[model samples]
Target: MGFAERFPRWTSAVLAIIQLALTAVIIGLEIKSIFIDLAHGTIWVGFWASLIFIKTLVMMLFITCCCRGRCCATYVLAWNIFSGILACVTIYFDRTFINDPCKCYLGDKLCCAVRSVDSFRTNYTSILDQCGQAIANNDKTALQWCSTGSPPYDKVQYLKAQLGCAVGMLISCALYVVIYIFACLGICFGHD
Candidate 1:
């Protein structure tokens, strides 16, 4: 009689897929940060999220093709609980990255006034070259510019996206647990 009892079976699969996609997005964003040398707190988040994602994929395959009955439901419930806990932990780490300002540097020399991803990509080499020249010549104005810069658009956006995806995965896992509980109960009561 509960909402989960009436929920479509396909919905569980859909939720699992959503969680998988979200985790992948978080991982991809983290990889992007790593490539740009902006990865700080994201490293942990990415590592854990990747593990959860892979296990979820395997679980989904097992459940879809092989799992059956209340035992399978119990297993699913347990997995969801585990994944939910991981998502919570990742979210906590993700918050630290989101709250911190973006730090972009070339061998300890910070880029100046670079605000957007487009600006970073288009002018990074030039900025590096200019900073190097300024350093060699001890150009105070250029050096000051190199030292003072805003957060990069790409990093900020990636962190925000990762946070959002982590939250989504958490919600999906909780939903899966609820659905599996009702499924197990329904099986027990011969209402399945």
Candidate 2:
């Protein structure tokens, strides 16, 4: 009897839980990026939106596998391998996507800057209002102030989020491949 033959039943269940968690996190990050992209009128809205959908679908499949237990090991392994590959591709695309607040309307500049301020995470509306007044008054320094703020703009935060998700997804992908290999061995050796 080898590792697969002695593979405990709880491992699969634990993996399912982990898969659920990774999928959920990825979905949340993608949705957040999508919102920011939409507000900034980014050309990549469709791509990010699709990522949310894909993560949601992957979560659903993970739940199904969890409910079915070890009996569906082969199928689960296949699904995870595919999902892992998809996540890798998603990460690559996310890392390559351009993030720039200047691309949005001028009115959005202040909001973008305020949103990037980690301390003012919730007071974005007020900051935007104040910035809007300056813009309306034709304040020449307003653009300079907003653009050169300590936090810069929301694009920076959005890029951080994308990078975080991509790193997490990449780890999940490696874990999935490892689990899939174990499952393959277990099945081939007729381990229960």
> For this target, which candidate reaches the highest TM-score against the unseen true structure?
1
lDDT of 2 by residue, 1-192 (tens): 444344444555555556556556655655565454343323343255345435534543554544434445455556556665666666555555544443444354543443433335677676676678777886656644534553225454665665565566556556655765776677677776
Task: Please identify model 2 stretches exceeding 4 Å from their true place.
Answer: 1-7, 39-71, 98-152, 186-192
lDDT per residue, candidate 1, 56-150, as tens digits? 75675566556644566566768778888888887877677667544333333453433334556788788777778887887756755522543
What shift in Å separates residue 44 of candidate 2 from its native position after superposition?
Answer: 6.4
In the predicted model 2, the residue pairs found to clash are: none
- Mind sharing the TM-score for model 1? 0.65
Q: How many residue pairs clash (N, CA or C atoms closer than 3 angstroms) in each of the candidate models, in the order given?
A: 0, 0
